[model samples]
Target: MATPPITFVPSPSYEAALRRAAELWGIQLEFWDIFGHHHVASPETLSSVLRSLGVSSESAQSLNAAIESRLWSEWSSPVAQTLVVSLSAGAIPIQLKDSEAGAEIRFEWESGGHTAVSVESADSIHPDTARLRDHQLIRIQVPLPKEATLGYHRVTVSTAGGRRAEGRLILCPDQAWQPDFLRRGGRGAGVAISLYGLRSHRNWGCGDFTDLEHFTQWASETTGVAFVALNPLHAIPNRQPYNTSPYLPNCSFYRNGIYLDVERLDEFTQSEWANRLLRSAKVQNCLAELRAAPNVEYAKVWRLKLVFLKLAFREWLRRNPQGTGRREVFLRYIEGEGNLLHRFAVYQALDEAVHKRDRNLWIWPDWPTTLHDPDSPQVREFESTHATLILFFKYVQWRIDGQVSAAQDFAQGLGMPIGLYHDLALATDRCGSDLWAHPQAYVQGCRVGSPPDDFSPKGQDWAFPPPNSIWHRDSGYELFVQSIRKNS
Candidate 1:
């Protein structure tokens, strides 16, 4: 077959603007194509990419305009979203426009420590000034003192106009902490597995937390294993077939409740709920289909597992509605998780409710417009009205949490160096709960995945929106921290 030709070549004038615009917006336009062809992205592609990155670069005039706006947005704005400083990277630079030449920049450290960056004449720290947009942009060099601690800090820039811009000052280390056992590093063996692959006699179509514990114990006892790596074990709605990929999870913070080990549930000991749940004709039929199939029947497994979980949950609640140790532990987790957990639970409930009304409306984008905004009055009303359903989601998460905690404890008891190692996804789906909860924090048109490679030809687009680089940093890398901690 003759290869199709690439369209939308750039003119010289347009090309220069595109190049300059791409440089400013940090878009890579010169990726090699699938056929070992070296090609530059066309003007249209560049404009679209730049536009997605929040740069309005559609035309030559607009391109220049966007560049100017970016200049002010980056260096000339009162401040950036954040100033990331790593001890390995040494010093950092701060910038402001000519009008704010004498702005007072201060570092308010966590140890009751402080650094005042402004002094008379701006002479104390060498200031480099360049002219752009008819104004001088000054870059001020600031050095971190050796005594500075590793934590989130605050940076404030107060301009001459009495205007103040606040930004997060993230101080990262050269490397993440590795335990002494890992640092010593002898030839310790490890294994990775899809959680669903740990099948057994009683699993509801797929593996569960109980299987993980058994596997971990067996691995540790039989082989001197250090860790067990897992693919992204993210949450999905109880809805069938579409909740397929772990990589394309609805929420990263919460585990897929389908992974809950129903047999190991406290409710099993409390009454016949566990036995009755397993005995259901629909549940047994689905489980049989899943177990007999070579590959996972994800839809069947999800439906069957959800039914069992809901039944188990109701049974547990009946026995221990309040004043129970489980309730106390769950409450403690909620307290620690704070807004993050609550918001995820609310998103799940809203997502499920919306899906029930219309199965085609699985994603938040397709939902009623008002429900998109997490904090909108309509959303708040929906939450209030469907409070029980939201709490059910929370209960599911808590149940999952308990089982995961047990798995970790089991591994630790078995003397494994690292009980679990979770793989983090590069980005989240725009249609998923994370993006729906924080829309502005992600790029709309950009995807996070590999470029064109020989195997499949046309480059892979994961269809996940990359987090806004500026916003992620501005968040003091909170999302990244949360992901790592939860997965751990």
Candidate 2:
């Protein structure tokens, strides 16, 4: 990628414009592609932009036009006009156009090992175009052929000038959704062990996914255990002396990538040093000895694994290029299922946050004015720079997911009724992604906890925010259902 040129700007007016736009849109807008071109717009900015576009004076019409116009203008002129072809869709309202010759749009797909393209709009989409006083908006709803592949399919928008815009349509598997095993059958007939708070010597500095997997394997083979309940594997902010508690993770959906088993990298390729290390009598004996041991020494194991995993990741990247079809699918999964992923990313970001102590959490909000709002431009820029760290978190979760699934498959191969069951934390940290992302859904002041009873005299304040019962009820427990679905 080429580095965009930076241009200096006049101070007061430029700063005023940015503030005005942000206030109007409720989002900070900074231009990266356009040098020194900062145009931030909020809902209010939409209204302002619409008025400037000569929409009807009625409030309702103005609001609607404002929204549509703003969305359209965001991609207009230099962004759109320069393109030989353009494409867009969904709630963001994708638009594709060609400046030269007006061309007929075509849709294509492979059928029975042969490629085909649509001849007419009636065969698939309703072709429609709208012309405003100064601009044109084209709307086409292209329908896929019945024989279209059940995964990802490309859609192409073409113009007469031979210019084209390409986009994708993902077709998810048409399987019937399964309810959580615990929910449907009431915990089943299985022994439940709390794996939380177990000390492990093999983890880096804290118990990790490797420990969980090892325990699951042992529980399955030695005892006929169907489920291994463990603590939340959420990403902790990368702060040194990392957060030791599992329940207070930054992101629940995203896996803490650091927990990826380093041993697996050996399967990728041949390295003299690695091969020799594995073949050495000392290393061989260590592996053989650990196989007979009941538990792992986490710190030692992690240190060994980290050394190899880095080498493997480098080799893997060298063989596979970025933005490939596989990579895109992976990215889509993250974007679609990223609420939890974002949490993990936020956690990692906090670890790298400025002032070392400021990990995007409120230690004492009043102390640092700059660190107060997470949505500020400074924070957003920080996130963009460290976006790869977030992706790393997602990749790690994917690897762990594969391992856990393999464990389940192994149990099922032996004809077990229930394969695997994972434990979910009762609540998330108040300063974490869950609370920050869904502010309206969380009650900030009161923390979730168990009331005092026979077990203990004083009530417990877990220091985590519980889902608002009222909101859950009204939302048909969608959050709960989604969480269960993800775990299952």
Candidate 3:
């Protein structure tokens, strides 16, 4: 048999504009497979990608128009949308049409102080010039001062003609935070395990922080590891097979309440109701069944733990009252967490309320359209009406944070250098609190996925919306940073 002759297809007239537009929009035009085969993006794929990014690529004129609009918007601006200044990278970039006139740069630090870019300091900074459609686009680098602290600040660029533009200026460290041992050139290893899979005779069917502390000590003693890495402790729906994966968590900023050691909490020890419930034969039977089961019973464990946590929360409220120092600590935590924790708690409260009213309502999208948005008036009313219920969820998170901290402290005290190494999941559940609370953070039309590899002949569709890079940068990447800081 003879192989068929290879057929060549003519490129579209808009192909050049499409590629240029894609490049400006940060879309990959081609890729190399693991088998050493080069794969160039087809025009259809490129158009679809451009559409997803809110750009039009239907024809040559549309492509050229989109490209021109983007370029004009960027080049005409006095400064870029965002800037990062690391310890090693000192100068900040700015753009203006008049280079001879120069521009003034001012920074408004998060600490309520202001700093102006000095003309003498940036004397050595070079200026690069380019020609736009009709005007000259000049790019200049202004030296950042050594006194700038590591945080998010606001930068304003002003021309002599009174035109100005503002952007976020993020001052970051040269590298991420590292342990002292790693900084000193020491190498170490640890046992990575799924916290939910950890079994202990004392646990209530699922692994808790108490179980973690004990396991950490044992692992360190037996394996002589510097750290014990655990799976992401992110909160999940805790339902059956569909909603239990830690990697696709209900909320990236919070931990699963099931891992909380209810018995270890002070409120649990103090609550007569909680103790009585635990002592009951009905509760004991459920605990025993869960513990003896071959797999983690996510639903049952979550239900049981939630009940105990509610009781404990009530007991805490009764014992500590509002003015006490202990109560103040929790209040401070809520305040420190700001709107992020509040929105999460509101979503949880709403989820429980809606599901209880209609047993079929599983996700936020299925809830009443009015309640879909966290900022909607109906949702705000629900939050106001169910303030105490929302506080219960917050209290659960507060207790979880304390217990997890204690476990980490125990591990560190046991001579482990890195102590607890918590993992952060890249994907957030589409139907989870994060989506319900902050839908703007993600793009709606596309799901994040990976190309085919040796592991699987078919490509993988992760089934979660890709983050909106535009939104993240506009918000100064607060949500992204919080995902890390809260998990850490």
Scored by CA lDDT, what does every candidate get?
0.74, 0.49, 0.85
**Residues 1-488 of candidate 1: C-alpha lDDT, one tens digit per residue:** 22232122233476687788787567777866667788777878777878887777667777777666655666665666677778667555666655654667787887787887663325535466556656666766556666567877787878775767878878888888877786787546689999987778877667888888888888888876888887778886545555677877788778887788766777765657668657789667767778788877766676666666667777777876679997787678778888888889899888778878897886788899999889999999998998877877888888788888888888878887778877776666677888887777788887776766777567787778887776677677788778878887
Residues 1-488, candidate 2: write the lDDT tens digits. 22232222222343344343333444334332223334444555444432333333235434444444544553332112111111222211224342443434333432324233433322323334444434544443443444555433445555544545644334434454454654476443445543333445544333445565566566667777655554555544433343435567655544444555555544435454566666689866665654445554333444455455545654555555677876676577678765655654554445444435543543323225543455667567767887765555466566667666676676566544575566565666565556555555655644566545556546477877555544554344456656666656
Location of the lowest summed lDDT over 10 successive residues in candidate 2: 83-92
Q: Score residue 324 of candidate 1 by CA lDDT.
A: 92
* Clash list (residue pairs), candidate 3: none
Q: What lDDT does model 3 reach? A: 0.85
Better model by lDDT: candidate 2 vs candidate 3: 3
Model 1 poorest ten-residue lDDT run: 1-10
Query: Any runs in candidate 1 off by more than 4 Å, and if so which?
Result: 1-15, 33-36, 77-79, 88-90, 96-126, 133-137, 158-163, 185-187, 238-240, 271-290, 315-328
lDDT tens digits, residue span 18-51, model 3: 8888897888898887877788989998888788
Model 2 CA deviation exceeding 4 Å by range? 1-222, 236-242, 257-259, 266-312, 323-325, 353-374, 470-478
Taking the candidates one at a time, how many backbone clashes does each contain? 0, 18, 0
lDDT of 2 at 324: 82
- Candidate 3, residue 356: the lDDT equals 97
RMSD of each: 6.6, 15.5, 6.3
Model 1 alpha-carbon miss at residue 176, Å: 3.4
Candidate number achieving the greatest TM-score relative to the actual structure: 3
Ranked candidates (lDDT, high to low): 3, 1, 2
